[model samples]
Target: LKMGEFSNGLFGCFNNCTLCLITYIAPFGIYFVAKTREKIREQKGIDGGFGSDCLVHLFCPLCALVQDAQEIQPAAQAESMARE
Candidate 1:
């Protein structure tokens, strides 16, 4: 659970100015949401439908944003752990 705290939404938003700025701006938020959805759906093995994706970002942007940022690319993460 604690494995991804560093890159999680709040951490990213606080430490990375660009992530914070894009979170609140509509045009930019769209990009963030799309990227996040891709990352989660493709990298994290999640089944993310467009409607659910939009709902998450549109309704609870903070948590949604945090969740999106909360991991390494799945392959790299798995590989690193295997090496350890």
Candidate 2:
């Protein structure tokens, strides 16, 4: 992935319906989205602030969550495999 670029589109949530459904149904889903966004920014060394993250989640929360999930899913899977 390149700097400031996501591997998936904003509305690509359907690509991973499980994640999308979880994010949509879970009460603590906002927290998960926030953390995921932080992880993505940190891993990619992208420039942004928590305030912006909050605003994004506060507004287009689902799309942001889906984007974050798509961005990190592969990395998380790879790390899980590495540990095993």
Candidate 3:
């Protein structure tokens, strides 16, 4: 699954400086929850159960966002390709 540099650990904070800054400060939980739900819908999950999900978001929040984007985007691209 291809993801934006801003969303990959290797190229994350280095590329998305502004976002990382914000994440470092706030670690927006609402955004994380929404992205998590989107990933769940795509059937690309980080693991079920509310507690684990919350822990991942509460701790490594940037990585969580990156993960959700990475998981959902590739599947979406594949589905679009299949339709074509």
Candidate 4:
């Protein structure tokens, strides 16, 4: 996950909490959360999968960052290719 800056206050405390939560808690919990939600959604015959809220709030940013990193990678690769 990409790290962001933090400052002091309630917001900062919450941010710190979320950072820790995502780093420690989310990895273990997310899989089960997604799986259970998926099963429920499937049983309910919903078209969309689980974690839409979380996806919008968390995964979307990560996805965009990944895309940005991927875009930069090709240019870096090209530069390395040229150097060789």
Best by lDDT: 2
* Top model number, TM-score: 2
Model 3: pairs clashing at backbone N, Cα or C within 3 Å: none
Instruction: Give the Cα-based TM-score of candidate 1 against the true structure.
Output: 0.44
- lDDT on C-alpha atoms for all candidate structures: 0.69, 0.79, 0.69, 0.56
Q: How well does candidate 3 score on lDDT at residue 43? A: 73
Q: List candidate 3 segments past 4 Å from native.
A: 1-46
lDDT (Cα, tens digit) per residue for candidate 1, span 1-84: 446454465455677777567666545656567666876687667886766777777778888777776654565688999999
Off by over 4 Å in 2: 1-32, 80-84
For candidate 1, the per-residue lDDT at 62 reads: 83
Candidate 2 lDDT, 6-70, residue by residue in tens: 88899998899998887675436556566668878989898887667766887898898788888
Model 1 spans > 4 angstroms off:
1-28, 73-84
